[model samples]
Target: MQNDFWQKMWASGVVGFHQPEVNAYLKAHWHKLLTTDHKAMAGEVLVPLSGKSLDMLWLKEQGHDILAVELSLKALEEFIEENHLHRRFSIQDLVHERFCGYELEAMRLFCGDFFHLTREDCQDVVAVYDRAALVALPPEMRADYAKHLLEILPPDTPMLLIALDYDQSLRNGPPFAVSEQEIHTLYGEHYQIEKVQEDKFERKGVETVESTYLLNFREN
Candidate 1:
């Protein structure tokens, strides 16, 4: 998605994608997706294209460090204030729009392009929660998005991906229709894919199917 598109969305408050509560799927299945270190688990979880989702807070409650990359600073500020964590935060860097710790939680929010992140910036990331990122991109950008995740994140990183399947003819989207087959085509070689759960529902009178996928990025 273009930076302007995202900026406008935040400025205009057109964020239907921003849920008021923690995602139920994430609440239910988070532990199953943690990275294993031969015998014990290690490393932080990455939330790419993360737009101040309360899911990050929930993840922190699970005793995991949270690293989130979002395009909008407004969303980040709102997140801090809304959650009553502003006191624990300080301006670590204004130019980068980076901050550390929130409500005494080990949380970091980087207000920048997700594509610009590097291994040095996120080497500890061993897992990802993609509740909104993949489905937010258009078709042309999806393949490259997958490639970037592979480039910056650790090889064999575990990911819990939530995607929506709907008739494209009915709506033009930031919440686009991405099928299970499309996910395979994009990340199949790099990751092992499994459909863990799914739910069907209606949004704006359009029937939609939302599915959760467990992605294990394969090692070399």
Candidate 2:
């Protein structure tokens, strides 16, 4: 999606995709991705394409630091204001030219394109929670999204990814359909993919299936 497209989505309040509460899949399976010791990962949890998600707060409550990226400044501002997080965070501008960043106690949000993020920027990220990032892109862009993630994240880093699959003829998407085969095609060479859960439901009379995957880098 174009930058303006998302900016307009926030501006016009056409943000049905934004969930009001923390995601159930995260609450259920987040522990499955953790180390054997049952502790949070060592560094920040990366949330790409993050849009004012309450999941960040939930993760913070679980003792994990957060590193989230979004293209819309309005979304980030709303997140801070709505959550009353402004009282706890010390906001600041990032040194980079393409991105503006805001920092709070244990969380940081970068406002910019996800593709513009570099390995150095994510060096400290130990795990990733991709509730909306992968499925938000078009088919042509998903490969690049996966590749960039592989490049930036450290080996053995785990990710909890949620995706939707349905007939494209029924609807256009920011929530695109990504099947299990496509998920493997995207990450199979480098990551061990596990379909942790699958749920089928009807949306507007159309059958839609949501799948969750736990991905870990394959040992080289």
Best by TM-score: 2
What's the TM-score of each model vs. the native?
0.90, 0.94
Kindly list the per-residue Cα lDDT of model 2 for residues 56-100, writing each as its tens digit: 999889888899999998999999999987677676656676689
Q: Clashes in model 2: which pairs?
A: none
- Which regions of candidate 1 fall more than 4 Å away from where they truly are? 35-42, 88-91, 94-105
lDDT: worst 10-residue window of model 2: 34-43
* lDDT, model 2, position 154: 66
Q: Clashes in model 1: which pairs?
A: 156-217
Instruction: For each of the candidates, give the backbone clash count.
Output: 1, 0
Which parts of model 2 are misplaced by more than 4 Å? Answer: 36-40
For model 1, how does the per-residue alpha-carbon lDDT over 67-158 read when each residue is reduced to its tens digit?
A: 88888888887888888775755534433433322223577777778887788767887688999899999999999998888888766678
